[model samples]
Target: MADDKKVLDDGELVLVKDYVEEIITDLKYSTEDNFTLKVIYNYSDAYLRYGTVKKLKKAQEIFKKKGYRIKIWDAYRTVEAQRFMWEIYPDDDFVADPNIGFSNHNRGTAVDVTLVDEAGNELKMPTGFDDFEAVMNYDPEDEKNKERTENASMLNEIMTSCGFRRSTTEWWHFNDTDKYPVVEGFNSII
Candidate 1:
């Protein structure tokens, strides 16, 4: 890792809210609402690499000007959490297999996010967070899914323009192009 890079294990991870207050956070791992059906994180605040947070802040500013707001679902997952998630859903498509390697999220370089209207209602997207079935069923070309496709596309474009790469499988997931080492033995709680 670069000398200036921040990692969760080193206690240098940054809170997303501290840099981008305009971005709303609803960490699914911190609640039972996730596919895991369990609370995986003890902290409610979202944490990410400082550089990744800067990219997110840029995206949030663009969303704000477009009459939308950014809502983050997950960020900066610990290696232990990655292992737990893999045990529950071993599918490599959505959840990264800890045995092979950790996810970009485990390195604080990936984030799952969505767009919300001014009223805080989520915009119509192809699928909700962590819904692999919905992703498979979605057809971006179908007229029935036009609005959803458009919203998802817009989110992808803005995020990519701000230095994040969209996941080919998960619409809400984005990874920072800059690489970072996986954070091991880091407590998720603030």
Candidate 2:
């Protein structure tokens, strides 16, 4: 690490876009297309904790070998943004309670992501980002979801292989809490 001042200034978060090659980003909160139907973030950059970025880079290396790239939807949300999100969608199962504490995203240890092909097209999963419905809940035994399940499984394998764990509620979400401690508050990705 550099100096404490630098680390604190940067919020101990690295811009994953700067470290990873060909990483596609589509931060929904930065635009009006998200669940809130309003622009929340002032910018579109994505960020993760220093340790989380290392895991994400390793996962991306594995994905590239298999002809896929990572597509990030959200990462390192600010506390203000989290509060706005919770006010819009107060479901504990999906959105974390800002009053209680920051969620994985707010901690800068979680990422909402899916895989993309060599052509930069997103791979189909159970559902889109922030769906927050039963469809987002994945089950391996469901015959109807074989295709979706397989895609989700592949993503889980890639992420887990690099020290990340998939969220049971959202396939696109992953955390690196076991290997790296989650940092609460905000990383100033906005």
Top candidate on lDDT is 1
lDDT of each: 0.88, 0.79
Most accurate candidate by TM-score: 1
Q: Count the backbone clashes (under 3 Å) in each candidate.
A: 0, 0
Model 1 misplaced stretches (Cα beyond 4 Å): 1-11, 188-190
| N/CA/C clash count, model 2 | 0
Question: Per-residue lDDT for 93-178 in model 1, tens only?
Answer: 99999899889999888999999999999999998888889898888999999999999999999999999999999999999998
Q: Evaluate model 1: give its TM-score.
A: 0.92
lDDT of 2 by residue, 1-190 (tens): 2332443332367777766756888888899987789887776888887778877888888889999999999987777888898898898878889897677887778899999899888887888787766554556687987888798889998899898888868888898754334455543543
List the candidates' TM-scores in order. 0.92, 0.85
Prediction RMSDs, each to the true structure? 4.1, 4.0
Q: By summed lDDT, which 10 consecutive residues of candidate 2 come out lowest?
A: 1-10
